[model samples]
Target: MKIKEGFVLHSVGDENVVVAIGKMTKKFRGMIRLNSTGAFIFRQLEKETDEKGIIDALIAEYGIDEQTATTAATTFVSQLKDAGVLDI
Candidate 1:
């Protein structure tokens, strides 16, 4: 899965924001603010990846346990999906 076209991630100060652009603005409006972890996951999704890939990357990047990484990745992906931001 990947982030759909037309959505871009930008860093504002110490925060990360996702916004719709061009034709995507027709479907999605406003911005999605994300914390650092969310921004990391979003960056991973900018390319093609799956849940396991995300979990593994999260674990490697943060040195977190498997369970914690799995939970975070799953929850974040679900949120993005519900928000119509994922290509999967």
Candidate 2:
């Protein structure tokens, strides 16, 4: 999956957020604040990747095991899907 068009990630002050821009504003409203982990996941989703890639990324970044990374990546993907931000 990859991040869809019309949404931009930005850092305002100390907070990082993903905001809907251009035509995407019609479907999604408000900004989604991203913590460090969320930002990492977002960056990964910026490219075309599979669940294994995400799990590997998380493992490389956080040194977690496969099961833990899988759970975290799955949860992040679900959130993006629910928000209509990922072009799955």
lDDT of 1 by residue, 1-88 (tens): 9999999999999989999999999988899999999999999999999999999999999999999999999999999999999999
RMSD of each predicted structure: 0.6, 1.2
The C-alpha local distance difference test score for the whole of candidate 1 amounts to 0.98
User: Lowest summed-lDDT stretch of 10 residues in model 2?
Assistant: 7-16
Deviating ranges (above 4 Å) for candidate 1: none
Considering every candidate listed, which one attains the maximal lDDT? 1
Number of clashes in every candidate structure? 0, 0
User: Candidate 1: how many backbone clashes?
Assistant: 0
For candidate 1, the 10 contiguous residues with the lowest summed lDDT are 20-29
The Cα local distance difference test for each model comes to: 0.98, 0.91
Best by TM-score: 1
